[model samples]
Target chain A: MAKVGLFLGCITPLRYPGIESSTIDVLEALGVEAKILQGTSCCPAPGVFRSFDQEVWRALGARNLALAEEQGVEILNICNGCFGSLSESSHQLREDPKKLEKVNNILSQIGKKYNGTAKVRHFAEFLYRDVGLENIAKRVKNKQDHLKVAVHYGCHFLKPRMLKEIDDPERPKILDELVEVTGAKSIPYKDKQMCCGAGGGVRARTKDVAQKMTIQKMENINEVGANVIVDVCPFCHLQFDQGQEEVETKVPVLHLSQLYVLAFGLPKERMGVEAHAIPVNF
Target chain B: MSEEGEPKLVNPEFTKEVIKRGADTITLCFQCATCTGGCPSGRITAFRTRKLMRRVQLGFKEDVLPSDELWLCTTCMTCDERCPRGVKITDIIMTLRNMAVEEGHMAEAHKRTAGMLIKTGHAIPMGDKFRELRKTLKLDEVPPTVLCDPKLYEDVVKIMKATEFDKLIGERIDG
Candidate 1:
């Protein structure tokens, strides 16, 4: 069992502890040792902070990566926004020594150094590539045969295809396959690859625009008859869960960890399914 | 309609600054509207990512820097990914935003969120009801995050101070 540091970005720890708990439960159930990343701040939200100051964004991201490197473990992050920031910063710093030097100079003031050692891995990629579908299939005790899932591969998971080359950016099948491994049907939906309208600081800077984007996504999901939306990022989860309330829709949203925990035969109580704004009937 | 020619407003330094900020491929754009066609924000708002690209190439710094349309971008990267010219459209938008912040042209909501981030390490801080919800789930009332630890919160503030992020967002380090 590989011990991996978990980078729980701001939203997951503060807004949705359920996703945090379920992530731990699911990873532990899969025989992977998950440790909380100590003394970590926000992924700082790449869209928000990066837009304001790229140097600060790189420093913050490098700091988080250095934490995982000090533990001698790669990071397994739950939020796609964190994946974007950490992975992009790690990639940039690793590829460019000058940038690494600049970032390390900033980090050294606070007793830290990023030697460009740690790598960032999103939880979806971890479950699919590291855990393997066959191994996950064997452990599934409660197959969600009755559930129809609309998989939301949040933008950061597979965007800027150069930086995050995890899957086919246009038509990513990894999340769909991972969802299917739990015996749930990953239904096809319109604009499946569209942004959740929450990323890039849209949700903060402009409410009506963000809500309109969410409403459009919810309408697409409704058209596909998906009872619940399964997402990998908590920011996207928040957009779908709470964003639905503003749009007057009731589509239940589940983090991939929550869905995986559910299919692992863990009760809803253990997965913290009750914390959802739109209750999950199953 | 009298044909009175208005002065052409062009600041070549604007284009140079954007490239220096990491949108080095801005020159590759050939007025292709693919970015605008694919922009999600453009669909719902007055933001045209392609037009912004054109404005950058033309060095329309004054027009581009202080516009509300600049903040309308969600930075979804859809435009960047699909651009035929291989222009880093989204990064350019981010660069423009950084310049806007330097000129004190930030949106109010974004400033408020930045204040929240500096204070709580979260753009959207968790409310009390959500704290109660965590307890119901048998998890820590406050997850072991910056919100739960004073030292960690200070570390976040320290990084902000070092980067002058607090100052950029109109925050005081002493506070």
Candidate 2:
């Protein structure tokens, strides 16, 4: 129930509005005041700079951080990619004064300066921490008793631990806990820790690589007989949901927001269910 | 192995944002070749992410952009996750791909695909053949939201403008 800025990266807002609609529903139901960050861009992601120039990565990411800082609020990210890139980059700037100064110098040209002033949080962390799982379950007027869900922890949020304050890095429990709030069963599955093929912008630049990884994740989820896979990151959600068709997988994928909307008994249209590639019958 | 000031010639048009957007991840990589080692295309050939990163960081734009190896990356994100430094291998590749498009350096096959994506939102055209497949599977479908909306490009551009990516790119292109 805290006021925060909602950061939806390049793909989520217009491309996947269902995810946004559902995310908003859950947060508002909990009495949280979420304002969308108007000036945010691509996380500008680490891969771009880590490949092109070391210094520029810090600057672009810091610029993103500075924009959130402009609002003077902790920014909760809907995409795991954005959360991972922003939080990790913020940590880097705060930890290294020299690097921070160089990044700030670049930002000054854009009229922005980041001293790593705000906190970057993923929705999973916000849900379990701020709203509390017990509180979320209390509002579940309609329960999805038949929906068997697989909780996918996106790699960026799951990796290089200590940054993800919500769930344990290895064997994450928070996402599973959120699924339970809908009265859905969160299945235990193998390769549950695997990365989505879409992250790091692979789905955009490289199709074969992205599709192959999607196939691997698809096979893993199928192996467990999960009816649907639930996830936090837009990158991950797109991969398993729509990207599954890049190969020939049938199991549907759901962003956590999408799934939660269903459990909340909202209209399927509002959940943007029609937009999904793998149709969610539930 | 090279000496400094041998005339450090970065392409002037490649702004800090351009470089940052595309290949900034070069520094986060080491020469482990894990990216290449696990690369789906590397199974058939010897494409290596480490080598690609090395070239990009060195500003070997031509080498990085048009390489058949660069086109072969599948973007599994495994390497991005595996990197001990957590460098994003896929986004780096995307940046290089985007630069190739902007510079008209894209290979014949690559340019055609980008054109297809711009027009269809998919890399391949769906003439009658795909419709037949959809009918066969009973997989009735409509254009994805990102594609169905006539104004998707304008909306995306607006978001980019919101983030000032437009301004960043404009500055470099105008100059």
Candidate 3:
């Protein structure tokens, strides 16, 4: 079994621990070792904190990468935002010697150094690639054919297509293909590639604006009659799950991992269903 | 709102400064509105991605920085992905935001989040509610992270200090 460190960015462990637990359970069931990366901080959240200071952003991100290097494992990021920040930081550190030197100067103070050897893999991409769709299809103990999921390919996971070669950012089929493997229908929705409006510090700084965007997305999903909103990112998970209350719309939201957990015949208790503001009932 | 006010001088230095910081694509924008048209935040907010790029190109630092419009972007990167000119619109916005912060133009909510990082090493710290939830899921009450280890948390604080994150975010006050 291949062992990898799980990079659980803030919102997953702090706001939705269920996503973290479900990811571990699903990965373990898939015969992969999922160890939580210790001493990791926020991906520093690219849009919020990274916008404030580049040096600090790179330093902290490199610090997290360094921790993974210590454990002798590649990072398995559970959140899109974490994957974006760490992946971008790794690319920058590898490409720019000056940046690596400056970030190393900061890390030296804390007895850490980012050798740029750390690798990050998004959980969804890992499932589609390493785990193989056919293998996932075989593991489906409880197929959820009744689920009409509005798949949300959150911004960072696929956008800036030059950097993230995961899929076609505008017309992605990776998530849809992955969803089908579990016997769930990846229903088409209006503006399916649109963002959930919880990113870029908008939700944190301007609630009304973020709420408006979330409402717009919810309306689109509602129009398509998607029974559930399935996303790969925890922040997007929070936006859809909790943002439903503000928009006065109730569509049970599930992180992709939880969707798999349900398909794996895991008990609902393991998913922390009660933690969601929108009740996730089958 | 004064139409008769003297026209602001275009500071070429500001444009050069942003370009130097790695948003060289700021100059590649040819005033095409592809970025604005695809922007989701622009649809609901006063943010205009095209105009912001234009302002940056013209070195209108005063117009671009210190404006609440800067905070409205969701950083969704839709504009960046759709630009025909291949301009890195989202990256330029981020670079502009970094400059905005240097000018002390951070939003209050962002500052509060920054403070949280300073105190807990995680912007969104684990609340008591999640602690109970984790326990029910048969997981560790506190997921092994900077939050559970003192040495790791100390390293986080030291990095924050080394990078002047604590200084930029200011001191955090207890709730």
Candidate 4:
């Protein structure tokens, strides 16, 4: 059993409640003894500062991390964006001498510091590393059968080439491995490493561009002949799921969290499947 | 010729501002088309991600703004992650979107979606059917994370306060 700060990203909170709820369910089902940490905020993703104001992005991100540190718990992120930003910022705080000084200065004002403390774990990583796939398989009351899923790692969870976390940057298998625990087959695609085009406010920015990116992602999914795309981030799920029409393809999207919930025999309704852009048959 | 000439852009000022604010990652874009290829939203419409970045590089705000292309993006952050040049493509797109909404020029669907998101905290708009289904399944109602945790509300409130996101949507009743 491990203590955790459930770092639900912006999308999971407002868009994909199912993922958040299911993550809690899966973790609890695993008997890991998890608890949601209080006082969480936007990861202040590189989406904000690295593009507009690195200073604010860092300051704000440090603020989020500080809360996790203050609580004395490891950070478990559900969103790829938060995973990327938090991991990178944590890297900066630990390795980058200059960034640490600058971010620390801002922290002084907030009376907080990143402090090189606490490990940031994506929910999938948490299951693989902390709980182990075999351990999770033991708890699966219902394992999905004949379900084919295409895993979308998204970009933030795998890239920037420096976070150095998870498996392969282009072909990560943590999601696939976890899907196996639920008795689901994870498929591959041409654009498996492609971005969902939901970052940078693309969904809110303009539908045209959003659709363009969606189409490409869908093309990849279409080629794989998978019924669903299993993912971790809610934003990615939104971009691929709700944005699937925008993807110009009609494959359903499922968060790895939802799969876990279903594997525990949670009904589709309990997992928020109907709310998805493409309704899940099961 | 590509390196020697000015890249196409929608808003040079917006691009300049983005770059000046440490978004020089936009400057590293060499038009390798990785972002365009990797972009999930770029496959729709005529608005190519590469072209959008080009427009940003050239700082053509007039061209970039007021286009359905800008709002089309879902901001999944793929381009930024794959850019060998490390271009902050998502950042550029977000700034442009924020600017669009600030000016009250966003698409009606976008506004309605935002409204729905604000009101229900859920992207898809569904009525009592799902709620009743929740009851039938005996599913734990969507645990109001906000209601369950006031502290999160406070933190978000502060971040929004500092970012002035609310001010940007003045007099706009979010559905």
- Model 4 reaches an interface RMSD of 5.7
How well is each residue in A166-236 modelled by candidate 4, as lDDT tens digits? 67776567778888878888877786776677665455545456556667768878887888788878777
For residues B1-175, could you state the per-residue lDDT of candidate 2 as single tens digits?
A: 2356575455534435445553455676667777666654555446777887766666665555556566665444557656776667666676666565455444443334334433433323445543443333233232232334555434434333444444443443444
Off by over 4 Å in 3: A246-249, B1-5, B171-175
Deviation (Å) of A280 in candidate 3? 1.0
TM-score of each: 0.95, 0.67, 0.97, 0.71
Best lDDT among the predictions, by candidate number: 3
Taking the tens digit of each residue's C-alpha lDDT, what string does model 1 give over A193-226? 9888987888887888999999998889988788
lDDT of each candidate versus the true structure: 0.84, 0.64, 0.87, 0.66
Clash pairs, model 3 backbone: none
Candidate 4 runs further than 4 Å off = A13-15, A44-60, A88-118, A244-250, A266-269, B1-20, B23-175
Deviation in Å, model 4, residue A137 alpha carbon: 2.9
Clashing residue pairs found in predicted model 1: none
**What ranking emerges by lDDT with the best candidate at the front?**
3, 1, 4, 2
Q: Least lDDT summed over 10 consecutive residues: which range in candidate 1 chain A?
A: A266-275
- Using Cα atoms, each model's DockQ against the true complex is 0.64, 0.10, 0.83, 0.21
Per residue, candidate 2 scores C-alpha lDDT tens digits across A108-196 of 65567786778888888888888888888877878987877878887766565555555556567878888988988998877677666
lDDT of 3 at A115: 89
Task: Categorize the docking of model 3.
Answer: high
Across B22-87, the per-residue lDDT of candidate 3 in tens digits comes to 999887889879888989999998889889998899888888898999989988998988898999
* Model 3 / residue A206 / CA error / Å: 0.6
